[model samples]
Target: MKILLTAINSKFVHSNLAVRYLKAFTKDMDYDCKIREFSINDREEKILEEIIKESPNVVAFSTYIWNIEMIKRLSNLIKLVDENIEILYGGPEVSYDSQNILRELNGDYIIEGEGEKTYREFVEYKLQERSLEDIRGLYYKKDNNIFFNGKRPLMNMNEVVFPYEEDENLDNKIVYYESSRGCPFNCSYCLSSTIHGVRFLDIERVKKELSYFIKKEVRLVKFVDRTFNCNHKFTMAIWEFLINQDTKTQFHFEISADLLKDAELELLRKAPKDRFQFEVGVQTTNDEVLNRINRFVNFSDIKEKVDELLKLRNIKQHLDLIAGLPGEDYNSFKRSFNDVYSIKPEEIQLGFLKLLRGASIREEAVAYGMKFSPYPPYEILKTKDLSYEELLKLKKVEEMVDKYYNSQKFNNIINYLVKQFDNPFDFYYELGKYFDKKGYFNRNIGNSEYYKVFLDFNMEILKGDKDILNELLRFDYLNFNKKRGIPDFIGRSIKRGEEEEIKNMLRHKYSFKEYYLESFEIDIQTFLKDSIIIKKKDYYLFGYGGDIIHITEEIKEY
Candidate 1:
């Protein structure tokens, strides 16, 4: 019999680790098995045609919240083509309530949790004509009645086979690796909280697998571990190994900043710059809100640790904040935003709350007056403390944050502008309001247009000393883009004589060969037109495509 394990990812760059694991574990099985992956962006008809062409005896889908709806439709279409083919579903989205999913989706089988061992057993039983009544973690239908055989126990991490050692091609895809399974902390809003205890792979085995990835020099290896640094020793071991390797591969981890020990911090301090990126979930800074959600964290301590990490300047830090949470009104969330913003993280991801299927937040949602969409993702619309109108305002704030702050385009100007307001939140809130009024959020604007909007807003706010704002805007605009002409709103053109002088200076002092100017792909004439010259008592400098060139030294002063 032929078997096919498939997944519909949210993006094409994402690879399905679940199907790879299943394929690796059943490598020695008699049946022919293969893994096929597709993105939600693919056309439904194309996906259905591809599955029909495979003509497999069994088709198992790895389900997730992002792709559940798409999978249901695709599976129904597959059944229409060939009713004899068996259909199966697995993954966290369907694992919690297998019976309901089985009844609603009308699938032949559902593997609840820990699918490797149980799926191998089910395949064997089906191909060999053995009874599957005793198979744990298998949910099936018999005589139009659904039956669930209960969940399987979590497997020892060491028993799982390495999935990537045999694969050759991983171009333009993020390779996922997991040194451990399960999460130790119980954060109510997260699905990982439902699972208790942590299981780790043998250190030697993990090293061997990592060695394969390092040897291949994969572009990125993202750890899927729920909390990568839960075990200090395990984290240190992997970090030490990766740090010493001679490769360009970068690794990413989701860690708890407050839990980092002194040794781990010191080790990270010595690691190479840009080699690692850490994602810390700050969620919220409000203590009352944190308590209500049963999330254990010391906001002050997190800030201190994050500040230290920022000082290192080697690792990229991504701090996250959830906009809608229990007891977190707009005012309280503003405080959370300001607090996290002060840390100067490389990226501050402002996200909203999602009521996951099995998460505790969904279970207690009614008490907090949480209303959400009845579809996948189940994003919160409003709550008792925050109205739909208030949430709409925050949504605008999120858009502006993504455009200005997260884009890292106007870094220096944003820092300067925030100081003019009472706080960072006030600046973002006012900017969000302006963006909404002007309908900027409804349209897609380019980088240069964004700078124009910033300049206009600053002109209104500063009222006086417009030159300083213009100078700062010029600096920021040039710094972000390398091959773009200056926007007209920034300044007027240089005088005819000054323009001629600038052209002579560029040819005589900063020749194309001497300064490697050819690398910028800009001609001297275009550079002269776009350049902003700054004349000082001792030196004459100009900004062109983020470069500050001093031309006075080459000229003889009278």
Candidate 2:
């Protein structure tokens, strides 16, 4: 039997490890398997034609909320091309309630939980033309009877193969990996509902993966586990491997700061600069609101510990704040926002609650007067303190935060101009209101409209000249990030430098043009190695000159 395991990802940076896992641990000697990947840009007709030519007996497709609609449409097209082909669905979006989805979409079977062992067993049975009703963790129908094989047991993670063995070059800027299977916390608004228990993959196996990534000089490893620090022993061993990896690779983890111990904090603080980034979900600072959401984080401990980590100046902090929750009224939210703001994190990520399909909260949303969009995201309409109008205003606020606050471009400008704000969110809110009132968010307003409106807004607020307006605009567009603050953009962070010196092959800091030209004897390739970014316009420089002075135009590479 020939089986093609397919996973459609958003981009090359995204590798569906679950599909890789399914391929790695098939445990079937009677079948041959091929792994195929598809992205949004890939030609669907060509792909289907190619698959039809191969004539695989079975095709297993991984599903996720983001890719379901596209997958369904493609599945329909595939069925048209080859009606005899067997189709199976697995992964996050393949509801445990697959009876409904299968009835509507006409898939052969839908597998729930871990697919490795069950997938192999089902494949073996199929090879011998055996009955499908006995396959556990899958849903299938025959005539008027429907059967759901009982849930499949979890796989022995340690015995699984490293999915990247076939990936010739692991030289991506951002690659994701999982060290665990489930989340420990029962955050109501999360997909941890279906798989409520936590299970760890082998530490030695994880260390080997780290070695593989480090050998290829992978710049970033985004740990997709919900709470990396949930299992301290497993987490610490992984951290130790990362610390001693003898490579300049950076790692990112979404850890629960409230649960981190002193030793974890110490190890994190001691890590190399630009080597680690931690994204902490502070959801809300209001104790009652936190309790109402069935989230178990201690806001006080989160603030204290995360603040300590931020002070290390090594581990970059990305703090999150959710806009809509059960009891967080606008005022109460203001307090929560201000409370977290007091720590001055590197990045303040503001997101509205997404009512996911399998979250515990969605089941109870009706009781809390929550109205959500009936789509993949299922975003909340409004929760008690956050009214519809207020949420609309907050939506605009989200735009401003993405544009100004989170971008860190409005840092010095806001500090210099915003006097009435009690916290950073206040500054963002006021700016959002300004942009909304000026019709800046209108689709009809083009780039020129945006420049004009923002130019006017800045001048009025800053009481400054064209230079300051240009600076504010430049701050937003340039690749030179203050990363954590406003002192720099892509340009040099020189203050009060009124004199210019005649320079040759000038190295204007982050400018890619100069670096590319070997202005600093920097192998624009080796100096950057795999960590380099290819963007449009200027790389990250204010100005560079050999004889004539020229500014970078725009980013265009990647």
Candidate 3:
């Protein structure tokens, strides 16, 4: 029988590892199984036409919260095109509540839980080599009734084959790897909380699998493990293996900052700059909220470990804070935001709470008086402690953070501006309000417009020091973009032959052929072509055309 596996990703760059794993697991089967991937942004008609052209007897969809609505519509359309096409649903979205999903959608069968072994067995049953009743973790319709065999046992990590070797073309895709299968902590909002204890793959096998990406020079490989450092020994083995590899591939991990040990920190310090990145979930600093959500974390300890990591300055840290959780009001969330903001991570992901199906928090949502949108990605609308209006305010603040703080384009200006306020959160909150008031959020604006808008916002508040703000914004602009003429809004400092003087000063400092100054990390040639001289308190030359680096300290009075 012809079989086709489909994945609808949130973005074009995301490659679904689940479909790849399933296809790899059933490779030895005689059935012809092929995989097709599409993004949620793709037209439904285009996907439907492609699936019909495949003309497969069986089509299994990899489902998730982001793509469930589309899958529901696509599944119905596929059946309408051909009544005989047997549709199967799998992945975390359909893995739980198999019977309900089968009732809700036009799916003929549902594969619950881990599907590697179950799918292989299902393929065997389809070929008439085995009985349908014996296949575990499957919900199927026979004659007129639906049946679930039972929950499947967790498969051994080693039994699963590497997912990428079968297909070679992975250009511009973020490779997803899983060095372990489960989590030790019971964070109520997460799906990993439903599964107890961590199951690690063989460390040597993991190293071998990682070697493929290292050799391919994949841009990024994000580990899907929840709390990657739950097991110190297992985690360290992979970390150590990766550290020794002479590769440029960056690895990302979701880790608990509080779990970091002295040895782990020491090892991380030796890692190459930008070789490793960590995403730590600091949901809230309120102990009551933490206890209510079943997330037991000592914020002080987390801050300490994060501080140690910050000192290293090699590994990039992405700190996350969920805005809506039990007992966390807007004020409490502001505190949470400020607390994480103080740490100064490379990224502060200000996310809202989502009540995922099968997660412990979804069940406890009612008791906590939580209301969320009844749809895929069940985002929190209101909690007992937080109003819908307050949540919307936080949403505005989130937008401001994404544009200014996380973009790294306005680093110097943001660092300077936030100091003028009581706390960082208030500055972002006020900026967010300003954006909403000026009708800027609805318009599609360019980078120059953003600088102008930010300047206008600051002019309203910081009545004193307009020139300094203008120069700071100008410096921030030159730091990021090529030497586009300084915008009219951001006044220029260097004028009337100062450019030649600066060039002559640079020539006097370095050899004729030497273009790079190591201390400032600036190339004299590019600096001359794509840079501007601005003065805040002292004359400063800002370079562009590469990464955004601050040369504030390296500036000397000219």
Best by lDDT: 3
Best by TM-score: 3
lDDT (Cα, tens digit) per residue for candidate 1, span 1-558: 988898899999998999988988988888989888999999999998988899899999999989999989988998888988889888988987778889999479999878999888888887885578888999998899898777788998989988864556888889899889999998999888888999999887888888888778788899999899999888999899888888888899999998999999999988899889999999999988888888777799889899999999999998999978999999999999999998979888889899988898888888999999879888889999889999888887787788789888787667767778999888888888877777887888776788877777766655545555565666556555553455677653345575456556667545443331211111222223444333332223343435555444444452
lDDT of 3 by residue, 1-558 (tens): 988999999999999999999989988889989999999999999999999999999999999999999999999999899989999889999877779788888879999978899999989988999899999999998777899999999988889978887348877999999989998889889898888888888998899889999888899999999889989898788888889999999999999999999999999988999999999988898888888888777788889999999999999999999988988899999998999998989999989999988988888888878999989899999988899999999999999999888888887667767777999998998899999888889997888998887678877866646655665676667767656565678656656475455556666653423221222222323333444333333344433324433333434545
Off by over 4 Å in 2: 41-54, 129-131, 420-422, 434-454, 460-558
Look at candidate 1 and give me any clashing residue pairs.
none
* lDDT (10s digit) by residue, model 2, range 1-558: 788888788886666777777776763465788888777667778667767777888888899877777778778887887788888898877765677878777568888867777787788788775557778888876775667878777776676666666455656636778788788877788777457788788888888787888888887888888899998898788887687657788899998898889888788766778788899999899888888777766788888898788788988888998988876788877777778767878777778888876777877787778888877667888875578888887787678766655656445444434444566667677677878777667756533344454556655653555454444344433323222322222233323331122122233434434422201111122222342323322323333342222232222211
TM-score of each: 0.90, 0.81, 0.93
Error (Å) of candidate 3 at residue 97 is: 1.8
CA-lDDT, candidates in order: 0.81, 0.69, 0.84
For candidate 2, the lDDT comes to: 0.69
lDDT score of residue 298 within candidate 3: 74
Residue 272 of model 1, lDDT score: 91
Candidate 3 stretches greater than 4 Å from native:
461-464, 508-558
